[model samples]
Target: MDTTALLWLIGAAGSGKTATGWAVFRELAAAGVRAAFVDGDQVGMAYPAPPGDRDNEHVKARGLGALWAGYRAAGVQCVVAAGGVGTAATVADFAAQVPGAAMTVVELTVDAAERQARLIGRGSADLVEPAAALAAAFDRAPLTEHRVDTGGRTVDEVARLVLDRVGRPAAGAGPWPPRRFPAPEPIAGERVPLLWVCGATGVGKSTVAFPVFLALLAAGERAAYIDLAQVGWARPEAPGDPGGHLLRARNFGALWRSHRAAGSRVLVVSGSGGGPADMRRYLDAVPDCDPLVVRLDARPDVLAERVLMRSKGIGVELPGDELRGLAGADLDRAVAAAQAEAVRLAADGVGAVHLDTSDRSPEQLAAGIHARLVRRGGGAAAP
Candidate 1:
């Protein structure tokens, strides 16, 4: 392929774009094609929207542009982006990001009943009506290069259709490798410190992790940050990898390579769920790493208040992510589930250290974590 290709998959809530995108990416990898993928919402994750870019399409565009530069340098052939951008102008904006690349927009659609059923089944009853409105908006959207009705199709079927429309490589019959799925070889770089912050929901994992990332940078170490939940945005998850734990780990491997090449000496990552086994599997995905674990915990009362506030979209730090898995009526259920998770994680001893986040500011925790890493890694702060 002389030119780069980009496939942008768009859809309303529960339309299965993420699942299909994951399938497409996996199919390409199996066919021996170097490719990259991005969950669009995850890349443009600024809390306060950039001025004039209400939906943050511009931010997403910039992010795609930057990430593509890295992928292109590393020999990626194409990129698959999936999200909800409802206008032709927005498509054009994203296209402008990768100049000279051939961009194709694939819109996934479903019948109203199917849409409502899917969203409701996903525990997002509140989004049923809004999904209809967005589906209608997509109906009127311009530059819709291709459209596929994903109503009853399996994710792989939809992915095959999408790949067909976008011109993917045909798998040749020359494979003779062993059946076992081996762990990925470590990336070709010196080992770096990987700080994984984890805990129950509303325990401020991301809040603390981001600050630690900033602290590393402030202390003169090249640092990068990733939210495991964001990378695992795919649904109907991969076989035997419930919660997309390994899938996101696989994605993180790609990101780890990119960041490591750019001289990152430390990586700060946060995730809300995943037990001990899931955590160790991620270490496999990101090889050549000196791993440090920090589990943030909060008082039951404080945790409950934080969970309720987030569900209600009050005093939330991350916009557009408040009611992700919780519908209006699921607030109490979410609170209870979070409380239970807190206890379960404590019993499992998932982290090397558990920090009580009930009263400390994120910055304070970050400072302490940074100091500990520096001492443990024998000058982790130094470049």
Candidate 2:
């Protein structure tokens, strides 16, 4: 009998293992393959839920064993398993337990500080100490593994690496699909193209994205604005802490589902930040879509003015002189940082179009963008 194929992802916290596993599973599913995902955390919490503050090593182990057995019995041809199975001993145990299973162990590595930052941002205070411990554990573990550094990788990019290793074809290898955006009318199609807008905070990305949304709407095209930041903020179960911000951004898959279900022809996704990592997550969230990344640029003064204006329009109560202080100092630093990030993203093969928004209204910028899209045969002529 042919052995089941098992793709095991091992990594420290914040190493993108879970996200990679999920993405791989989705890709296989999309290809009409049967696959299952098994995460240690989810397995540990599967039955007879343990106390929130209690350690259940025995239960976790049993759950893991049962999960492996179930998958094997089910003849699951592909299994994407994610967790910190760091040691050679652990791999051996898995092999013994799941006889005839072809195991490919993937190790996701991230900088210690980055892992720590991600953990803290995810509201996992428990991970702070465990992350350090896990780092040490990984060094001591002797296991041949395929390594993926996720220090700055988005989940989808990391997922692509995994998919490649598992011998899956890369996305977009076949005929191009029709593009769609969220619209009032129903779309009768199997594939839809997606355009994503991403940039750093206060870069007027939304300002640019909204007009494109309106333009598409006016043209009777199906499109929608995917305000990821707003969705992140609106999550009710999110921890009321700073870490919730990153967690929400990473875990906000619902937004993509909503857009896809609405049959949006073009999705203008407003991301929280600009980076390879962010872009990866954005793409994974909205799968099988082409991304048109628009990076808006402006002079420091112009950026500062726009930030101040937005703050005022939102009815935020700042101290009497705080706006001026921020404009003079914080805003300058922010714009510089944003520019650097944009350049970094551009270098990552994001197909970015840079627009200098200085002295240009949103309407003018939209017109320019429309012209470029038309020239590229991606959009219709402006009405």
Candidate 3:
């Protein structure tokens, strides 16, 4: 008999539990382990009762219990499950169904603001209220043995965390020690990852990009954080608003070459525009580099608060040109600009991943961006 084990990844909607579960299932297979990946949502959908009742605590528990039993009896060594395991009763039901099997639960969490953005991005309507309800319920739910903050982590990274906690069932099957791919050729000429962080003023593009840059550097990858907005303002002789694209391109090229000489392997730039046109202009600057564009966004209220504090030097950080008009006037303009920019980015179809920075601090936001970059295979690519 195979020593079967079960792992339940529990979290609220948009907490990335499902994706992480699938990633774990795939990795376990890659490591020469046979694991069954079960999605509670799919299981519940096997039979419908009340509309939207699939996620009901009792309904999910019943469905998951049966699903686990089938997998266990089939001699599967591992079961990676996600969804609908948000409460103590549901978890207990799973335990009851699979007798003599050691079960581990890993709870994933993210801020409400990010979850809202994710749900909205995926076009999931009528979810805000229910999602909120579930979030509050989970807060009061029983504690799990392992807790992971999936706020800014890639699916692979989160899966790795779960695997580390619960050792693989088929251990020492192959490469007792995992093999690593060789490092890419040293960044030279123009082959490097050019990460562009864009959004309207007061959206924290520079703040987030700088930290991501530092993170890459700390990880031993040569990286540079460039604020194109700052660079544009520094040179007044150039034509066009905030310096023309031609001049900006010239400056960026020189900066890249200099950074390359200094052993930089990645370039992160934050600016105002994040649409297809904006990306094209960046590629014009570094014609040969792979581009990964990220758009940072926040609710109007969040944007207003950040702009107001920064404009007035309320915070310890030095003040800059963020102060456009009178106190309230500047904030209003920023809000409008951010809203309009978001609309434009969506319309332009640049395919940039929209990241919400409403409740996340600069560090958290940066870490999320870095995780996304790594997932996209952006940090370093072999030439």
Candidate 4:
């Protein structure tokens, strides 16, 4: 008998694995394939406990075993299953129970601080201990898995990743003889779109990008911020280097993939200039999705002033000599380089939009972008 393909989503509590699993199920169903999902937690809840003993590992094991058996018997060709399968033993059990099944284990990671914040925000303080325990256990688990960070991603975005990895049809055919199935619904949450904001340093890109993010939030859209600059600067081995910036870009792309899989509609990624060659390298490793790439431009004097103001607000104390040495000397050169780079990026199918942010606040710049997005018939825009 042929066994079904099992896609197991493994992660700590609050890691968004369940949400990812649901998204994968929907995408498969939409492609006219038969798929089913079983929540491990729900199955665990139904398992029989020892007499007068609510907690028993043997009982839990039995529950998971039963769940696996049911899926096998039903001949489920595709299964999206999620829970805290954070051990080698559990993974082995799954493999043994489902013979001839292809298993894709998705391991979701989130920064500890962010995971704590999410649990608290959701009023599930009870999750903290279990989440922490799972994190510890995962470190020692001997499972080869595709890892996804869920710190700032939405459910839909993560789901797409899972689908790409595991939801492809077994026979590469349309869904089994169609009966009426409900139209796929987006998992409920705020949509955050990924927006890549690129330009040379001191071009007011972040100034423009942050406000766009805020505007999306104010417009009742959910959004998240990723400052690629800090991501680069934090690199200890390559501090103050351009390669650091490139690494940051690659990391951002990976993180961006997770967010896209979770279903974020708007994501503003800010950093210095990267051309089409850079973009091609990025798309080669990551999935392709069209994002609005806004290139902000400003005069030399305006850029210097903006940089100085930003530095001051952040408490970066610089002596007049050093300040002039760094900011003044680089202003004109940076501005000219950025303008040239923006044109190059435009040639790479980036759909770049140039915004002169010299005289505008971040909010104004973001509003301008919103207008452009609307005018472009909801597709990418070019300037």
Tens digit of per-residue lDDT, candidate 2, span 1-383: 44667788887787877777777877675775545566555433212223552333333334345445444433345677777764565567666655677778888888888888888876787877876777778767636557778778887788887777657623322322221212223233554545556654566666777677666666666555555443322111222333233333333343344344434555556555445664565465545456677767666566655666644444222111123335556756755665565556556755477777787887898777766655655555657
Model 3, residue 313: what's the lDDT? 57
Candidate 2, which segments miss by more than 4 Å at Cα? 1-191, 234-252, 314-351, 375-379
Judge candidate 2 against the unseen true structure and give its global Cα lDDT, from 0 to 1: 0.57
Candidate 3 residues lying further than 4 Å off, grouped into runs, are 1-190, 234-243, 314-320, 324-331, 379-383
Give the TM-score comparing model 1 with the true structure, all chains together. 0.58
| Cα-based lDDT at residue 81, candidate 2 | 73
lDDT (10s digit) by residue, model 4, range 1-383: 54566777788888887667766766766665556665555333211233543432233334334444433433346777766765676677666655677777888888889888988877789989889887877867636567777777787887776666554765344323322222223333543344667765556666676666665555554344555543221101222334433444444454444344433455566665356655554433334444666767666566556556544444222111122334554655544554565555545645367767777877777777766755643323323
TM-score of each: 0.58, 0.41, 0.45, 0.41
- Candidate 3 residues 102-132, lDDT tens each? 7788888878888888888767756866787
Which regions of candidate 4 are displaced past 4 Å? 46-75, 140-142, 171-383
CA lDDT, candidate 4, residue 259: 42
Number of the candidate with higher TM-score, 1 or 3: 1
Give the least accurate 10-residue stretch of model 3, judged by summed lDDT. 175-184
**Best to worst by TM-score, what's the order?**
1, 3, 2, 4
Q: Model 1 over residues 65-130: C-alpha lDDT tens digits?
A: 655654454345667778888677887888877888877889899999988988887678998987
Residue 107 of model 2, lDDT score: 83
Top candidate, metric lDDT: 1
- Order of quality (lDDT): 1, 3, 2, 4
